[model samples]
Target: MGQIIIFLVLLGLGYFFGRMAESRHYKRIHQREQAYRKLLVMPEKIPPLEFSQHESTLVSGNVVISVDYFKTVAAGLRSIFGGRVAAYESLLDRARREAILRMQEEAKAKGADAIYNLKFETARIGQNAGQSLGSVEVLAYGTALIPTPDMRAERIARNNLVQGK
Candidate 1:
């Protein structure tokens, strides 16, 4: 009886902390998503020819995320039941979104107007011989199109007048 009680207590603690951390991560992700909504990301092989004056360069972002202890235990049980593992699904979703956000940030830093030819690469990392899934790594890459020097100066001047600067 004592051992069972201890096990339950540990499970409860794991669930509580794991849920808190996941919630915080999701909140942060949503905030960043909203902040970067203006960044154009697409999977086309080539940007439209109408913007031929712009220059394109490669940008990439990578992120690694690990499952919490509670999630690992839940996934183990789910395997026995042979159904979907929602915990791992959410973990991957968060990692993918974060990777995209980081990529967008890099493009923004370079004054890119849009991203094209977007692609993703995923890998599993940090697993020992006997260990379960240790972590997931997500890489997002794309071509960033930046306006020409003349266009940038025009945009800056237009914005200055609009803001009364």
Candidate 2:
């Protein structure tokens, strides 16, 4: 009886804290998503014609996120029932979004107007992968398109024309 009580208590605590943390992370992710909306991300092997005058460089963002206690417990129970483990869905969503955001940050820092050929790689990380749930590592990579000097000059001239300068 005592052990059961302890388990319940821990489960409740895990649920409460996990929910709070998830909410906060989601809020932050939404805000950053909005901020980076203008930075184009595409998964095409060939860039559009407009990007032909640009220089390309590889960029990547990696993030490792651990499952909360509540999620792990819920997933274990879900596995026994042979049903979808919804608990892990949000965890993956957050990880993927965060990885993309990080990649966009790098591209922005390098003066990239857009990222093309976007790809993702994911791996499970833990000491005992078979027996226990572990952290998920998400990697987002792409080619950043930066305007070359000639392209920049042409853009400047075009802007001047539009402004009647």
CA lDDT of every candidate: 0.90, 0.92
In candidate 2, the residue pairs with backbone N, CA or C atoms under 3 Å apart (3 or more residues apart, or in different chains) clash, namely none
Q: Write the per-residue lDDT of candidate 1 for residues 19-96, one digit (tens) a residue.
A: 999899999999999998998999999798866789989999999998777787788898889999997999899999
Model 2: worst 10 consecutive residues (lDDT sum): 126-135
lDDT of 2 by residue, 1-165 (tens): 999999999999999999999999999999999999999999999999988889999999999998888888899898888888899889899999999999999999998999999999999888355855678999999999999988778889999999999
Candidate with best TM-score: 2
Q: lDDT of candidate 1?
A: 0.90
Q: Estimate each model's TM-score.
A: 0.90, 0.92
